[model samples]
Each structure stands twice: as structure tokens, then as C-alpha cells.
Target: MEQFPILLGAGIVLLFVFWFGFLSLKMKMPNVILYILLGIILAKWISHHEILHFASEIGIVILFFLLGLEFKLKRLGGIARKIWPAGLLDVFLNLGVVTFIGIWYGLDPFYAFLLGGVAYATSSSITAKLLGDTGRMANRESEFILGILIFEDLVAPIVVAIIIGLSTGEPMTLFDSGILVIKIFGITVAAIILGKTVFKKFDQFLNKIHDEDFKIALFIGIALSYGGLALWLGLSEVLGAFLAGMMLSDVERIERVEQTVHPIQNLVLPIFFVYFGTTIQFVNGVPMLPLLAILVFWSIAGKMLVGIIGGKLYGLSPRVSFRAGLSLCSRGEFSVIIASIATGVFKIFSGIYIVLLALIGMLLFTRAPQMTNKLFGKPVKKKKGLKVPGS
Candidate 1:
């Protein structure tokens, strides 16, 4: 009988998600944000019930796994040269700017650095979907954005490790951080090598078995194993999932694995976004109206500035550069992950509310047609491609 209520709640959440997701698609709003808002409403009504919490946790794991499956090592490699420099610049510049702002606001230096680091990242899934939906996935600018996002993903854990060390008041010296980084790189390389060998052999065996269910089980086993190992090593599960995906990218069974996993991924991932929205408790009982207004302006202005500067550096036209900047403004899961870490490790309670507000505001503004029109202009031209920065 206990399971009955849980099942009923799950069904309701799923129903609302599908309904809102459909609306979002038709209205050109971001479905992820809509799912999150719905989750917040449910959480408020239910007051963080245990069943909902479990479902959301599972959703996060599935989302990370699917994110891993999307990693294309070949595509990333093809644009590494251009991507690395641009991505590095983007991270450093944004980090510098945001950090300055945090410090100016009297935040501790460590907290400022954490804020800056979180701000540096761009959401890979959100950006990819937007580009894909808009038919700009094949554009050179899109490739550049993809490459930068991949690079940022790779850099995130390293920053997290540093933040962890600093928060613990355990030597976060440059030398120590550098050593940690090298160790992480070594682990990554080892994961790739080991993953390739194991996945290759597993693929061969799965092919011979020729049972779809069995093959799917085998794939999940591999992903979960790697994910577990990563957690054991104090690394993020998403990093592990990404590595696992890269390992299996060359296997003949990849398409089958993707097909089998996608529905499960879609169904569960929204829960993560929803959990994100629900956990946002206003600090000190602050009224929602004033807080919301401040966050909205900051989120939009900060990202727009970054985009304009990045675009101009690349020699893009004023409009394209402005659009790129605006498009890049949306912050998703990574920001939430960083905020959670900040609260746990640094004891930064104020930052939690700040980041949550920023995230929610970003979601509210990151709509399709609105952002599209802001960046691309009316009747987005096909012939005139994105003008490269400094060109």
C-alpha cells in the first residue's frame, strides 16, 4: 500500500511533464525549464516527499549517462585546435569577470573563485538542443560552441577538485593543484585505454549473443561500472559517463545502445531539473519579487557581455556576436551542481540562493524564438554565415 502513493505521484509528475513539455515545444520555450518549474510546484505541494527525492536522484544519474552517450571524440578531435584556445579564453575571461563581481560584493575570495568557475561553464545539452532545433547544428559557429562546451566539461572537475581542497582547508597551493590535475589527466587517459579494450571485447560478445535485452543490459553494466569507479575515485559521475561513451563510440553496437537508452534517459532526466527547482529555498524569507528581478538582470547582462566580447574577438559581425553572446547566456545543470558543492564544502549558504535564483532566471529567459530573434534577427540569413571574430 505504501508503494501505491509513490506510484501515483510518479505518474502525476510524468503526466504534467509530458503536458508541459508538449506545450514548451509548441510555444518555443525550453522544455527542461518547464519540467523544472512543474517539479518545483509539486515539491512545494508535497514538501519534498521521499519518493519524489528518489525519483529525482535517479533522473540525475540517467541524465548524466545520456550526456556521456552524446560525446563524440572524433568530432571533438577534429576541432580541438580552434576550440581549445577559444574555450580556454572563454573560461578565464568569464571567471575573471564574475570573480571580480563576487569580490566586489564582499564575498570571500574562495567563494568568489567558486562563483567565477561555475559561471565559466556553458550547458552542453541546452546549447546542443537549441542549435539542433534551429537547424544551425551544422554551422561553423555551432561546431565551435560544441567544442568549447566539451572543453569546459573537461575543465570543470579539475576546478571542483581545487575548490574541494580549498574548502577543506587542506593545502590548495599551485603545486598541489597542479599535481592533482596531472593525476586526473592520468586517470582519464587510463580510463579511456581500459574502456576501449573492455568495451571492444564486450561488443563482440554482445553481437554473438544477438539478444537485444541482453545487449542493453551489458551496455548499462559498463556505464554504471565506470560511473561507480569514478565516484570511488572522488571524480564526478558525469566525467566517468563521458569517458565510457567515448570508449564505446567506435563500437558497432553504439547505435543500438543509444536507441535502447534514449527513452529511459528522456523520462528520467527531467526529474533532475525539477529537483533543482524545488530545492531553491529563499534566503532569510526574502520576498520572491525583488530577488527575482535582481537575478534576471544579472543573468542576462553577464552572459550578453561575455557573448559580445567572445564574438568580437573571433571577428564576428555585431549582430552575430551579440546573438552568440545572448545564446550562450543560459546556465543549466552545471551551475546547480556547483552550487550544491559550494553549500556542502564551503559552507556558503548565501551562494546557494544566489545561484538558484540565477539558474531559475536563466531558464525563464532562455526561450527559443525570443533568443533566436535576439541573436539571429528576422529571417536569419542562410548565405551570410557567422562572421568569425577578427575576420
Candidate 2:
């Protein structure tokens, strides 16, 4: 508990950062990048002391849980046909491309596979922000992108589970992956049942309290309880949080929950981003120009191909599809999580520093709307009687 002061101070600083950072966003910049930069600077000033690691981890867990809450299983079900095809193609194709590159870089087959998997996921946070920023949340193109992202988010944990099983070297096979899936399904069903039975009643009881503070405490209790259960079940904590959120999504108290949680989310989520920057070692005194160039090119091109194929399959116009692919190419927090798993848990991979550098480079280049527009051009406007791609 000696570290409590540092943790508390960090939380306060994060709140300030988020407040100012969001203000910066209104001036046409990304708060995410700003938060990351703040984290990096703080770490450098302190020489990378483990000051914010614990708080940052909590932030990530909560962020993932909130992600799950926003899952909208029903909405995803509506677009399953288009989403599944595009998502599968996106993941596999991106995997194949990255795997080949990994092999070319002299990584072994196992490491190559891990690298490919890491590269396959799109950044859900970034996608959400982009859609909101462009006012395209309701557009067809936006729907396609969102569907693909949501599908990726749902499937990512399964892939992570498979990678974890394989890394353990305990007879990972098709049967094992299947069994893992079954277990996850079982856990989901149990969570839904228990949540519906016990949590619904508890939440109702809390609703009768009529005190805002008590209601907020009840909301946190529910999120933490479900999130804890998920971790205990060997599932991602985010999955549990998501399930909890979904259960409460249609509740009358959802608006209150959102309001009470908003400040906490704003404070913690940025720490996750900043800690991401601090974790990057920037080894060998920063990557040289040649290696950086190759990584950036491949990262961009790999996603471009996935986007094009996805767009074509969805019968979108060539331009719209190309833009969609370009827009989806940027890898953010999810990629970092994959890299950490590769380096820390798997031990089968060695080029994690390089991957991290590559991802950061990609993030630096792709974290803005202007870069996206420069790459894909602005959405085409259609005549009054015609349909626009996003419209």
C-alpha cells in the first residue's frame, strides 16, 4: 500500500490530461495520441519507473470491459452475413501477409504465426472514434467498418486463447481449440443466466435506493464482479465486463450508470494509452530508417489488401471499398496487447521490440483524420436522388 500515493496522484494527473486532451480534440487533434505523449514524457522524466503500471492495467481491463458492454450482439447478428465473410477474410489475409513478412525477417514458423495473429486485429477504440468524428456512424460504409471491427473484437480473444494454448506446448490441436470454444460458450451462457437471475434483482434493489452515490457504487460492484468472474474463468476480463454491460444496456438505469462511470472512464482510459507509450523500450536507440520504412510499408499494405477484398465482397464501389480498407489499416491498442502476449507469455517470439516500434510508427502516421483523408480522399457527395457511399 506504499504505492497508494503515486497511484492516486497518477489518477489525478490523468483526469487533468483527459480534460485538456479532449479540449485539444475540439481543436482538431487526437486526445489518444496526446495522452500517449503525456505518458511517454512522464516516464522519461522519471526514467521509466513503474509508477503507473498498476493503475494502467486497471484502466485497460475497464476499457476492454466497456468495449464488451458496447458489443450490441443483436446488431452484430443483423450483419453477420457480410461481417463474417469480411472479418474472416480480413483476419486470414492480414495474417498471411504478416506471417510471410515475419518469415522473411528470419523468424521461425511459430513466431511467424504469432506475429501474424498480432497483426490481424483492428483497433476498436480508434474505429469508434473515427466513425463518431466523421459523423458517419449511421452510414453504410461506417456500418461495414463497424461490423468488421466488432467481429474482429469478438474473435480476437478466441485467437488469443489458441495462441496461449499453443504457447503452453500442451498438445494444442484442432480438438483443443474446439474445446476452448466450448468452454467459452459455456461460460457466456452461465454468466447470462446468473446475471439475469441475481444481478437483475440486485440492480432493481439498488435502483430503489434513490441516492446517486449508492447507485454509482452499485454500478461499479456489478462491473467488477462480472469482470472478476471472467478472469477467473480464463476468459478475458473485457469479455466479462462486456457481458455485464450488455445485460445492463437496456435497463432503465443505464443512463445513470453511464453518467456516473463517464468521469472514471475519462480518467483511466488515457492512462492505458500513456502507459502503452512508456512500455515501448525504443530499443537499440530507435530503429534505423531502412527497417522503419519496410515495417511501415508492410503494415499499411497488408491492411490495404484486406480492406480491398472486404470491400469487393460487400459490393461497395471501388473507391468506397479502397477507402474502407485504408481506414481500417491502422493498428492501435489491440495490437499492443497482442505484442505483449507474444513477448511475455509465448516466449516463442523475439522481435517484439521491432513489432512495437512498427506499431508505434503506424499509430503516429495513422492516428489522424487528415492522414486518412489524404490516403482515401473525402467521401464523395452524391446528387439529391443518388446514394453516397457513406450515406
Candidate 3:
């Protein structure tokens, strides 16, 4: 294949993405799925490109940062409280139950646990975008969905770190684990303190800036910087981007800020999904077909159970809980991240599983409201015609 200049390649990719986006609108499909398909089709050329990877990261970070702007410190705390029970249930069902199943199927314990990690985590990127696209961001179950995603984000890195340690024959010590915990705590506290103090005065400073270009640069810079800080601390950049947004929650000109951020996010976010698609290779073909089937079934079941049971614990009504359950079944980036560590058949298995669940999850998400309404929505009474007496 002839190599195009980086600039030309990027332009072509973006144009393809635009075409996909147009089709998504016409078909009423989620762009996430479409972008991934585009990636798979172009995988040979674009696979493992560093520029693509960095651009994708920027897309996701901005998406989460926008999400954080909607949630302030107090609201975030309240959400954490309501979500902890569901969060625990999510871990038990998705991680614990899936791992147990993997072990029962006679896989090595370490690999089984790795499989469990793959099954865990609802794709925050996909879920967040769906919530916004479907206009469910303010819906009752959105809180539950976002809370569960956040909980998984916090837990998954530790799982990955442990797995990496074991994979390298040097398991993390208690000291290492403790240090990791402290880093997480430290970042959280820092975000909260900054939000309460520095960003409280940030709005006025923004008002003083006359140059729109400078303002846009500064706003995006803060988000990227904080997200980078999270990565530096060996944590997920999504968490950092979110906290960065929370930090700026104190600003009064949130509307203006969002206007500045949304176009950039929209422009780049599709590349992330496409890049995700480019990573999946089917070298060994599908392996352990039966085991894969069982895991897929349980992966869906586990997340549904978490949504139903955990949503109740989180105080959602039965119907809404069901909706939440259906919505939470998709796995994305985190699953891919964990799965990328596997070799041979395991990698193929993880790729197939991720693609399947992501497609299924998005479909379920789109249909949840209709399904819930059918199941639990109040029945409509048919009125008798006044002319029936004449009949």
C-alpha cells in the first residue's frame, strides 16, 4: 500500500467518518457502531497508527469532560452514595460471576480472571453518547448508568494493574496496591479542592478574556491537562477528564463553554470508535466457541441483573431499573484494553465478544424505553362509542 501524507490520510479518514455519520442519521443508527465498522474495513491501512490513537483519546476525554459539566461536586457526591450499592452489585455480577463461570469451564484461573475483566465495564464512551443522543441524560436511570460506569472506571485499572503484574511474574505488593489507592484518593481530593477554590474565580477571569481563540485553547487545555495528569498517575484519563470538567463546574458561563467544546468533541469522537475497530484481528479464528457462547450469555445476564437488582437498590422503580439493566450491557474501551493483553485464541475470543456485546448493547439501549413501556407502562383503556347504543 502506498503511504499518504499524515495530513491527507487524516482528511480521508474524517471524510469517510462524515459519510458514515450521514448514514447513521438517515438510518437512525448510533454512529459508534458505524465508525467501528469503518475502522474494520480500513483496519489494514490505519491499524496501530499513533496519530489515530492520540486523536481517539482526545475524543473520549472531551466527551467525558462535557459529561462532568452537567454534574457539580455536591451532585457527584450524592450520586456516589446512591450508586455504591449498585456499583458493588455490578462488580459481583459482571466481574465475579463471569470469572466464576470462566473458571468452571476449566480455563486457568488467571486467564479466567482476565476473561472476567474483559466482561466487566459498560463502555462509558458509548453509554455517555447514547444518553445524550437519546436525550436520556436527565432521565432517572441515567444517573444509575453514569454511576455504574464511574464505579467500573475506578475498579478496572486496579484489576488491569494486578493482571499485568501477574502476567509479568511480579504480582503487585500490598505496598503497591496501597500506593495506587492513595493516588486515586489524592486525585479526587485535588479536583474537589480546585473546583471549590480556583475554578470558583475562573468564570470572572474567562469574562475578562477578549480573544475567543485564546479562550477555546485554554478551555480545551485544562481538560486535556487534567486528563493527562490522571494518565501520569497510572489511572484512566476518563476519570481525569471528568474531574477537570467538575473543576470548571463553578464557572457561570457553562453554556458558552459547552458551545466551544461540543464541535471539537463531535469532530474527533468518531475516530476513537473507528480506531477501536481497527484493533481487532481474527488470526486464529474464533476459539473455544462453547465457552465464548457461555461467557456472552452470562455477560449480558450479569449486566442485566446488575441493572435490575442494583437499580432497585439505587431506588429506581422496577420498569426504570429494567431499562437501566438493558442499557448497561454493552462493553467497550475497558474491555478492549484488558483484552489487548491476551495472546492467541484469547485475543480473538475477546475481540468477537466485544463487538457482539457492543452491537447488542446499543440495540438494547435504543429499544429500552419502548420495551419498558410495553412491560410496565400503564395500560390504555378503550372508550366505548356513544353510537353503540344505536347499534
Candidate 4:
């Protein structure tokens, strides 16, 4: 009851956040930048930590769950296996190189690992949006782009899980690593099996419910519950939310689930961005500018270079390859998620890096098509009615 004022203030913050996003969209600016900007402004407001933490946590869970709904089990396996080489290269360039750079800067090994994970994944939401805006979805290089984005979505959870496990105050041992692996494997396999057998019937039951609102509520409950259960099982709840999405992917029409849930996701995900922004107090002791510059470079160059290599392996031209690589430059949700969960230097570094990366990625996305056309006339083939869902 005493927290009522804080809740009111938070609602006001969300209104401004929504307006800022709307304005940014009109200007073709990434909303993440606006969220971060608003968050920084809110920093001076002095809000309670718990409410923000809870909203932001649920926001992230819903985000990953929605992200999972985008890919089906069958399509993902086919894509990942075909693009393994490029996916492997993306890991090396973005993650591995950035980690080595972190080490070279004299940070601890653990921080370096965090930095690598921070650099490794591209922002699926932004990339997909940009492609739609630019009319490049069916472009020759887009298949590769989609493939890599899917790959990142897959890799991010495992990396976050490991980082969380090792970064805790307690020292990690071989026994702990074994326990982590078993937990991940056991839960994931069990979820899949149950989803197909037990949950299939349950999903059919959900589909039979005539009340749309109730069905939507039930789906949201299932997603969040699995995430909570995963947390209790000593694994990353993000992974659980993702697995939950995958489990229901086949049984339900993703289109309906997404339509029902996207509004909820919209309301919450930005809170994470804002909550993260408020925590960014770069003060006297932090090496703010230097790390920002390096990570900005690391985030862009690594993705671009790896993207080029991936494009080449996929038999694209040098022009197409460069465009493909450049297209992957933006780092969004996962990078921010990594920062939010961490503390001290790691947190600060990730926040600065992602903001810079997002800005740079946005700038590059504008130029990828035009630049590719300049390099080779008509980089994209004639549009032949390719439909990317949720694009």
C-alpha cells in the first residue's frame, strides 16, 4: 500500500516511454535508444528498486517467450544445421574476438567471458524490423541473415545460463558444471517429450476454449510458470520460457498466440529497457569512454566480418557477403539482458556497449542495401512473394 506513489510514477514513466517510442519510429530511430534515453532521464527521479526489478524481470521472460514463438522446431533444425559454419564464424568474430579484447584490457577472465557473450548475439527484433522497412526480406542475403539471427537466438540462452552460474559469489567446480549440464539437458528433453505427449492434449483443450481472452490468459500463465519452474531448477528461466514457447509452437497457431501476447510483451519489454537505463550511473571511477568506443567497434566489426564470411560460405558475392555481414550489426535485447543481470563494472560496460551498438547498427542498416547496390547493381533479386511471418 505504501508503494502506491511509486507505482503511479512508474505508470507515468511508461507513458513517456510509449510516446518516445512512437516519435522515434516516425524518425526511423531505434526505440531502444529512446528507452535508454528515457531511462537515463528517469535516473534522476529516484524510484524504488523492487517494483522496477519485478516488471523488468517479467518483461524479459515474456520477451524470450515471444521470441521462441517465432521459430518452430522443424524449421530451426533445418536452418541451424545448414548454417552451422556461418553460425560458428559468427561466434568467433563477435564473441571470441570481443572476449580476447576484454582480456587484453586487463579485465578478469570471468568479465571477459561476460563481454564475449555481450558481443556475440545480434538483435533479431531490430534486424527484422529494418528488413521490413527497407523491403529487403526476400533479398538474396536475407536467408543468411534469418539463419544467423535464429542461430544467435539459440546460442544466447546457453551463454547467459553459464555466465549466471559461474558469476555467482560461490566458486564453481566440476561438480557444479556437471550439475548445470544435466539440469539443462534433463529439463529440455523432458519438456519436449511432455509437450508432444501430455501437453499436446492440453493444448488441444486450450484450443477448444471458445473464450479468446481466457485462452490467452492461460497461455501466458503456462509460459511464465515454466519460466518460474526453471528458475527453481537452478537453470536460466529465459531458457525455460523459450522451451515453453517451443513446446506450444506446433500445437497452436503461432499467429494467434503472438497476436494475443504481443500487446502484453509490448507493455513489459520496454520496462526492462527503462529499468536498465535508470541503473546507469557512470561516475568518477568508471572508464566510461574508452570501453564504450572499443565495444562499439567490437560489436560492429565482429558481426560485419563474420557476416561477410558467413555470406561467402553460403555462396553469396563479395558485395552480398558484405551486406549480409553489415546487416547483422545491431545488438539489442540479449545484450541488454546480459547487462541487467550482471553487477558493477560488467553491468555498466554492457549498457554502454549496447546503446552504442544499437545506434551504429541502426545507421548501418540504412546503408546496407544502397551500399550493396553500389557494389553490385541490384543486390537483391526480384521479389517473388516471400512472406516472413511477423515481419
Candidate 5:
């Protein structure tokens, strides 16, 4: 048969995604893993398709942008202050320890660090979706989980930049690293200033406008442009997109704005996962099975430790902390981005690692509350008015 027209092909892909999404809802499974599996199955047909890649980028940027919409500068400051210690613990366990393991396994230091970077981040997309889908957004542990994800977002870009530099044999100097830090700081400050000044009055102006088209265009433009700016500055687009959303959080009717952008984000975001799956190439059978086993074990354990210890430090109860840890073991987009840096055996290794851990993480996340319940039992409720001998 002649090839389907591009538009028609795109429509078919969306239908498949919608079907998978529906199945996920019915089965109570996270749609993320399903979309990824779809990508892997369809990789032969769709691998490296430019349009899919671009759409995926748009989806993720908007996802982070929407996430940013939830936080204003003041609230963000509070979260940062409370979450830093746990964030530091996360860094040490996932990145620091994993890198050490890599070196011990006989890989060069650079390769080892790549391994660490792959292990360092939890899948923000997966975690966020699970939180929303599982109705865990209102759970006690959600705040801690989100805080850790945000911390990883801030750190991963710098790690990526450093990795890129090292991979190219032009490793970043201390001065260069300082410059990157400054760029991140500058962008953050600029977003804050814009939110406080320009967008502070945006609600009144938005109310004055009647065109939904213009409103969405403005929202998406800000997200993509900021994300693009981060790329230009040698940082992560997710960071820029997040800052873009935060810049608009000062607007009074932000929910209405989100209502406009959320559909578009949902539509494109599945493509991101599917595209990710397509990028996984397994030319040879899994390389270094023993090493893969070790890294996989550590990936889950490291994140669990971060969640449990960090949660305690953040003032959560032990039960809540354990649940938080269980939900964090899945590594997603950041892992994929870092893994793309590898070639040959390492690339295949990272691919398998990401897919396996993502599946396990999703399963654990779905079962976290139950798992915690088994360990701690349900929190006992006190009898009301049953009361007191004194009474």
C-alpha cells in the first residue's frame, strides 16, 4: 500500500495513544508506561521521525510549565528551604554512590559519571502523572515527592552540560561551571522579576481580552520560548519552561489560563513517551547483565533511601516517608536524555535500565500506599466523644 499522508498518519498515532490512555484508566495503570511500550513496538516505523520529536518536546515543556503554574515565588522559597537536605541526600545516593559503583565495575570515570547521571533523576513526568492519577496529590507524602523532583530538575541540567563537555573532551573548568550557574541564576531572577512586575497585572488584561486563541498562543509562546532560551544557554529546556510558568503564576486567574493549555499538553505529552520508546535501539543483546543487575538494584534502593531519609528530614512520618520512597524509583526523561549520550554497549545498557526501572517504579507507585499499610498498618483513628473518665 502507498504510505499514508503525514496528517493521516499523525491522526492514527493519536488514536493509538488515546486507546492506550483509555486502557490505562480502565486498568488503573499509569499511561506513561503504556505509551512507552507503544513507542518501542512502533520504533521500527517511527524512529527518529522529526515531527514526533518536536511534538514530544512541546508536550514536556508545557507539562513543566503547568507544574510551575502551581508555585509562586514565595511558596517556592518555602519548599526549597524545607527540602534542601533531602535533595542533598538524593544527590549523594543516586549520583555519588552510583558513580562510585560504575568506577568500581571498571568503567572509566566519565562513563561512570554518565551511569550516575542516568540514575540520579526520578521520572518527573511519570511521578507527576501518577500523583494526579492516583489521587495522591493531596496525600501527605506528595509534597516531599514533588520537592525532590524539583531539586532533581534544577541539578540535572548542570549535570547534562558537564557530561556533554566531558564527552567532547573539553571538560568544563571551574570557571565554566560558574558561568553556567550564573546563567541559571540569571534566568531564575528574570522570571521572578517578570512575574512580580509584568504578569502581576496580567489578570486584568487577560479578562479584558476575549480571544481564547490569543490567550493560548501567549501561554505556549512563553513556555516554548523560555524552554528554547534554556537550550541556547546550554541548560535544560524543562528548567526554562518551568520558570516561564512560574513567571505567570502571579496572574490572578491562572487556573483559567491553565484550563486553556492543559488539553494541548495532554495531547502532545504522550508523544514524548512514545518517541522516547522509539529511540531505544537494542542492536545486540543486553550488554553486561551483571552490571545491569547491580545498577538496577541500586537505582531502586538509592531513590528509596533518598525518599525515606529525606522524608524524615522533611518532617514526614515514617510510614509516609516509606511511601514517598517507593513512589520514586522510576527514572524517566532525564535518564533518557543522559542515556542518549552513550553509544555501543552502554547505550543498550542504559536503554534497558530506563525501561525496566520505569515499569518497576510505576508498579511500586501504584502499590505504595498498600505496601506502606502492610508495614505500618493503617493509622488508627481516635473514637470521637468516647470519652473521658474526667468528663
Candidate 6:
């Protein structure tokens, strides 16, 4: 019976998340920022629920799995061509700058590297949500934004694996890192090949399911199963889920899978942000504010700089380039995931830093066309649009 309160409390928090999300829709703010704030406000109350923690992990795996469903090798190849320069830009300017800033702030070199990573990847969840919400997915700049995001998503597993390994044991040598890379590549190749063979078989079975609900259940189970298998084999479960998603991307009537999974994502994704917010210990949070400010600035400006350079490479105008940078402003899921693995002040800094960046990213996304229009010529307005955001 005592556990009932935990469930009740969770339901209440989710209710607030839903309410705030509705309000944010009108205001054009990200729902994720609101969820985090709610979590922070109720942190003491929410901290004890083990169920929510597990749910949040499920949320992460499912979210990434769905993100993977959106692409195949061919689409990914196309995106790779468009994004590698900006992705490299994200690596050099956006990523490296923050690590330097972290060291300059007197953090240990290792901790600074972690901070760099924390700042490096923008939140695909938030950005993709925003793009979908505002109907900007078809925009030229959005393509660049998504390209950078997908590229980051692909790289994140490697970074997370390295950090997790280091935090648990002795430092890795260059040779060890090389071996890890090869291992991951091997897993990826295996997943792709396996997906091709398995999903083809699954599709044949899928056609036999006449009931809609059953089909949805089957698809979710398959994704989770593949994802779990991936984890068991020494890869990130999220990566495995992604591979599972991509495996069936080319399957007949896959849009049904996409639709089925979205509602699940919509429900679970907020739990992740809220749980992440609860993890932030605000007692010593003030001292990290200065560092947070610097990270937030780089998260926006660095991306903008990269966008300008990248946009030019694509023969886009300064306005479009600037918008692309703006699009990259937000960081969400990965940032929180990184912080969760760390202890002490670094974790606190990362948690708050992501919130700050998310808000900034939402602001930039909402105002993108307006900002561009102020200096450059007016953008062709897309009628009847939602947006890409965690909002």
C-alpha cells in the first residue's frame, strides 16, 4: 500500500507534465523544460521512486529506437554527406570549446573532457520534437539540423561507452580505445546484417496479424528484444534499439510501426526529462551557474558558427546558415544521460546546463524565421506548421 503513494505521485507529476506541455504549445516553449522544472520543484518528493527510474531507462531506449526507425542506410548515407562538415564543426568548435572552458574553470582534465562531451551533442529528442511540432521538418535548414543530430546520435554510443568504461576501471590506452572502436563497429555491422535477415522474416509474420493492437504490441516487443540483445552483446542498448528500428525501416507498411511507436514515445519521453530533472542536486547548484552560462552560450553560438560555415558549404545564404546554427542550440537526452553516470558537481552542472540550453534552443527555434528576417530577407513562411523541439 505504501507503494501506492509512489504511483500516485508519479501520476500527479505526469499530470503536471501534460498540463505544462499543453501550456507550452501555446507559448511555443519546450515541454521538456517545463518537465525538468517540475521535477526540480518536486525533487525531494520524487527522488525515492525506483519505478520511475526504470521507466525512464525504458523511455531512453524506446526514444532512440524510434529515432532509428526514421532512417535506412541510403537515407543515412545522404545525411552523412550533408552533415560531416558540420558534424566535424560540432566536434572541433562546439565540443572542444566547452572542454577548454571546463579546464579553464579549474576542473580536472578528465572532468573537462566529460564537460566537453556534455556540451557537444544537441538533443535529438528536443530538436526533432520541435521540428515536428512547428512543421519545419521540410525546411532547408532543418535538414542540416537533423543531419548534425543524427550524426551525433551515431557517435554518442562510442563516447558513452568510453566514459562508462573509464569511470569503472583503469584508464584505457590508445590501443584499448582502438579495440573498443573495432568492437563497436563489428557490433554495428552485425546488427545491420542481422536486421536485414531478421526483419525480413518478421515482416512475413507481421502481415499475418489482422488486429491493429496486436501488430503494435508485436513491433514494440521486437524492438525491445533486439535492443536487449544488442545490450547483452556489449553495445549500448540504445544503439541496439536503433539498429532494430532501422532493420525494418524498409519493411512494407512500416509507417504503421512509426505511428504505433510515436504515442509510446510521447508518453515515455517526458518521464525521462522529469526523472533527469530530479537527479539535479540544487544545493551546490549555484556555484556551477557561471560554468553553465558559458556552456549555454557555446551551445548556441558555437552551433551558429558551424551553421554559417556549413550553410556556405551547401551554397546556402548567411540567413539560412544562421538558422541552422540556431536549430542546433538545444541539448536534451544525451546531456542528461551523461550527467546521470557522473557523481558530484559535474553531474549537477551537466543537469542544469542541459535545462538552460533546452530553453535557449526553444527560444532560438521559435524565433528562427523572425531572427533571420530581421537582417536577411523574409523567409518563405510555411503555412500550418508545428516544430522540432522537446517542447
Q: Show how many residue pairs clash in every candidate, following the order shown.
A: 10, 2, 0, 0, 0, 17
Q: How does each model score on lDDT?
A: 0.63, 0.63, 0.89, 0.76, 0.91, 0.76
| Candidate number with greatest lDDT | 5
Candidate 5 overall lDDT versus native: 0.91
How would you encode candidate 6's per-residue C-alpha lDDT over 1-391 as one tens digit per residue? Answer: 4445767877887788888889878866767778777778878888846777777777777776777777886886787777787778778886688878988999887788788778888877777777877788788787677677767866776677667777777776788678667866776787678667766676678678788788768777867887787667555666677777777777777777888777887787788778877876676436576777777777788888878997777566788888877778888777777777778766766776777787788788878878888878786777777876886
Q: Residue 181 of candidate 1: its Cα lDDT?
A: 71
- Give the higher-lDDT candidate: 1 or 4: 4
Q: Comparing candidate 1 with candidate 6, which one achieves the higher TM-score?
A: 6
What is the per-residue lDDT of model 5 for residues 208-276, given as tens digits with 9 covering 90 to 100? 889999989989999999999989988889889989999988788678989999989988999999998
Over all chains combined, what TM-score does candidate 4 have?
0.80
Please provide, for model 4 over 121-204, each residue's C-alpha lDDT reduced to its tens digit, 9 standing for 90 to 100: 887766765675578877888778878876776577668777777778565677867776787778778777866787776656
lDDT of 2 by residue, 242-346 (tens): 677766654554556677776666666666667766655444444234433565577667666666778778767766666676667656555666666665423
Per-residue accuracy of model 1 over 24-119 as CA lDDT, tens digit each: 889786676676667656655554656667666555555456555555555546666555556666775666776777787667888888777666
Candidate 1 displacement at residue 103 in angstroms: 1.7
Candidate 1 global TM-score: 0.77
Q: What is the TM-score of candidate 6?
A: 0.87
**Residue pairs in candidate 2 whose N, alpha carbon or C atoms collide under 3 angstroms:** 68-242, 69-242
C-alpha lDDT of residue 228 in model 2: 77
Q: How well does each candidate superpose onto the true structure, as a TM-score? A: 0.77, 0.76, 0.95, 0.80, 0.95, 0.87
Model 2: lowest-lDDT 10 consecutive positions: 345-354
